[model samples]
Target: MSSLVPPAPAPALPALLTTVLPALESLTTALGIPRTVLASDEEIEYAWKDLPRELREIPAPLRGELVARMCVAVSTGLFDSAMNYIWNAAILQLRAKIRNFGVPIVAQILQSDFEERNLVELQDSRLLELSLKLNIVNEDGFFFLDQCRDVRNNFSAAHPTIGTINDREFTTFLNRCVRYALADASSPRGVDIGAFISAVKGARFNSSQNDVWVQRLSETHDAQRQMLIIMVHGIYCDPNTSEPSRLNALDICGALNSGFTASLRSELVHKHSEYAAKGDEPRHTASLQFFERLGLLINLNESEQHAIFYRAIERLWTVHNGMNNFYSEPPFAERLLELSKQSAIPETIQDQFVQVVMCCVIGNGYGVCRAAVSSYEQLIRSFSPREVALMIGLAATPATTLSRRISSHLSCSQRFKQSLTLIDPASVPSSVRATYDYYTR
Candidate 1:
C-alpha cells in the first residue's frame, strides 16, 4: 500500500438536547408537545446538562420534566417556550414545597390573583415572588426568576412577540430554571468555625468530611467568617501550628470569600493598626504582605479582582516608593518582584504602573529602582512589541528628569532591550528617542 495520510474525519455534529437532558424528550413525547414547529437552522444547539453544575438537588419528577423542557427550549433557541417551561417548573416546585407545609402557604401564593382578577392561578411572577418571601430562593436567584418572567411575558409561546432571542438570552433563561426552580437543596450541613479552626490547629485535612465542610464553608457566611477568623488568628495563635496546615488553610481561604479584597481588607487593616500603634511594625508586616500574596490566589470575580490587583500594586508602590531608605530598600525591592507577577492588570494600567515604577523610584536616583527593573521579569516579558514602541513614544515629550529616569531604567533592563528590538526604532516615542539612543549605545 502506498504511504498516504488519511483525510481528517468529518467534524462531528452537536447532539440535540435529548442526549443531554433525556427527560425533556420523554416529557415532550408524553405531553405531545410539538418542538418541530419552532425548530430551524438558526436554532443554536448547546449541551444543556452540564451548564448548571451549581445545582444542589434535582427537582421532583413532574418539575424535572418541566426543567428538562426548559433546557431543551433554551439550547435550541426556542426562548419563548423556554420561558413557559421554566415558569411551569417554578410553579410546580413552589407548590410542592408549600403542600408539604399546608394551605396557608398556598393561600398566600394565590393572594395576588384573588385580590386582582377574581381568580387564583398561582401565576408565574407571583409564585416566584412568594418563593423569595419563603426563603426558597436567594436575592440573586429571585432576580433571575423575575427577569425570566419578564422575558417570558413578552416572548411567551401563548402570545406573539416583537422581540427575538439569541444565545445569550436563552442562556439567561436556562440559568433561572436551574438555579431556582429545580434546585431543592438550599441549606448547608453543620460545619462551623470551631470545627474548622480546631481541625486546622490540630494539622488535619478535614478532607474526608470535605463534602460537608467544604460545601458548608462555600455556602454560609457565618462558616466563612469563622474560617477567616481562624486564618487571621493563626498569626496570633499558637505557633505550634504546622506549615502544611497553614498552606492548606490558604486553599480553604481562597475558597471562602467572594470579594477577596473586601473580605481580607478589614483584617489586614486591623493588623496594620494594631502593630503600627504598638510600634511592632515588623510583627504586623506579614499581614500587609498577605495582600500581595493572597490577592493572587483568590477566586474573586473578574472586574473586582482586576481592580483589587491595581489597588494592591499602587499600595505597595506607596509603601516602597523606591526610596532606598533604611526601611524601604530591600523589602520594597522584594515587593516590586511581586508586582512583576501582576500581568492580569489591563495594559492601560500596566503602562502607568511601569512608568510609576521607573519614575518614582529610579527618578529619585535610587539604585533600588534600577535593580528592581530587571527583577520585573514577568512584567518585562508581558510587554508586547507595540507596548515597547509606546514606551519609546514617551521620550517624544520634553527631556525632563522623569523622562531620563524612565530612559535609564529602560537602558538598564536587558529584558526591555530585547522587546524594544522587536519593533522598528523609528516607531519608538519621540521623547524616548534620545533615551533609547543613550541606552542602546
Candidate 2:
C-alpha cells in the first residue's frame, strides 16, 4: 500500500492578516472612514488563527453560501457582520430542523395554527423557546443558543450594535451557533402525521410494518412522539375506528409502553380523565377499554380503578345469578380476574370485589360454576392484604348472599374454605390471622 501523506499546515495567522488587513485599511481610508471603524490587526489575526480550526468542525456540506459570506466578513475584519451572517445561518438551520420535524406537529404541540409563514415570522427569541419545547435543542443547547440570540440582537450587525464584539467574542459566538444548531446534523426527522395516521388506519400492521413504525416513533423527538401517542389513543378510543386500526393503535402503544415518560403518562391520564369529566360515556368506556387492553389500568387513579373493578364485578355477579350461569360465568369471571391482575383492587371496592368473588366461588345450592373456578382461584391468590382481610371477614357479615350460601350449604362452605387457602399466608394480616384460620379450617 502507498504511504499516507499528511496535509500541508494552514498559512500563518500573521501572514494571512497582513495580506488582507492592509487592503481593507486602504479602502476604508480612501473612503474617508476612520481606520478605527474596523477591527485592529491584532483582533483580525486572532480571529484568523481560530477561523480555520473552527470551520473544520463544521461539515463541508454546511459550508454553504451564508458560511462563505461569513468568511468574507471575517477577512475584512467586520466581526459584527460576520456574527450576523453566522447567526442567520444558525437560524435557517434551526428552522429547517423544525420543518423536518413537521409544522403540523409543531402546531399541535404549540396548540396553535403554525404554518410555514408562522415559522418564518417567529422572532429569534420565540424560535429558541419553541425549540426548547420541541426538544429540537436540549436544555444546554437552548441555554447557549438563547445567549447567542441575545448577542445577535445587541452586538451583531443584525440590529443597531449596542457594543462591539472582539475577535474572541466572535469566535465564542460562532462556536455556540455551530455546536448547538449546526453540529448535530443527524437529528431525527419528524414523522409525517398524515402518512402515519393513514398507515395506522389503513390495515393491520404486520410484523415488519410494526417494527418500522415502532422504530420511527422511537427515533422521533419526544414532543412529536407524545403527540403521536395521543393521536393513536384517540384512534383506539374512537367508536368508528376499524378493528384493524384499533389493533394497529394498540400494537404501537404496547411497543412503546416501557419507555413511556412521566410527562407522556400524565398526558394519557389527563386525556382519560377528560373523557369522564365531560360525561362522554362512549368515549369514556372506550378509554377504559384502551387502558385495560394495554394493562395500563394501574396508571389510573384509585377512583377510576374503583369504577372499573366495580363494573366488572357487577357484570360477573349478574352473570352468575342468571340462567345458563355455568356456561356464561367463565368469560365474565376470566375478565374480572384479568382486571384484578392489572392492579390491586381499590380499597373502596375491595369488599364488594371479595363478596362477589366469594359468592361465585361458593356458588348457589347447585354448587360453584366449575369452568369458572380457576379464574376465581387466581383472583383470590392475587389479593392484596387488605383484600385478604375483607375476604376473611366476609363470612362473618350475616344476611349477605355469600354468608347465607356458606351457612346453608356444606359444599358451599367447603368451596369457600378452599378459596381462602388460595390466599398467600403472608398476605393475611396478623390481626386477621385468627379469622383467616377460622375461614380456611
Model 1 lDDT tens row, 1-441: 799976433323346544534545565678898645443333454324334442223534443576667665666557678768767666666655544433442344344323323213667676667556545566888887788778777877857886766655666666666667665633322233445666655554556643455565555434234534445445432245466665555556555534444545555456545665786655544443444455542332344345545665676567555344435444554555564554355554656655544443343434344445454443544555455545655443446434665456654354334435544665656655676786566
For model 1, the superposed segments whose C-alpha errors exceed 4 Å read 1-58, 61-136, 140-190, 204-216, 219-245, 255-284, 296-336, 343-377, 382-428
lDDT of 2 by residue, 172-234 (tens): 999999989986666666777878999999988999999999999999988779989999999
- TM-score for each prediction? 0.36, 0.71
Note the Cα lDDT for every prediction shown. Answer: 0.53, 0.87
Query: Once model 2 is optimally superposed onto the true structure by TM-score, how far is the C-alpha of residue 198 displaced, in angstroms?
Result: 3.6
TM-score between candidate 2 and the true structure: 0.71
Which structure among the candidates has the greatest TM-score?
2
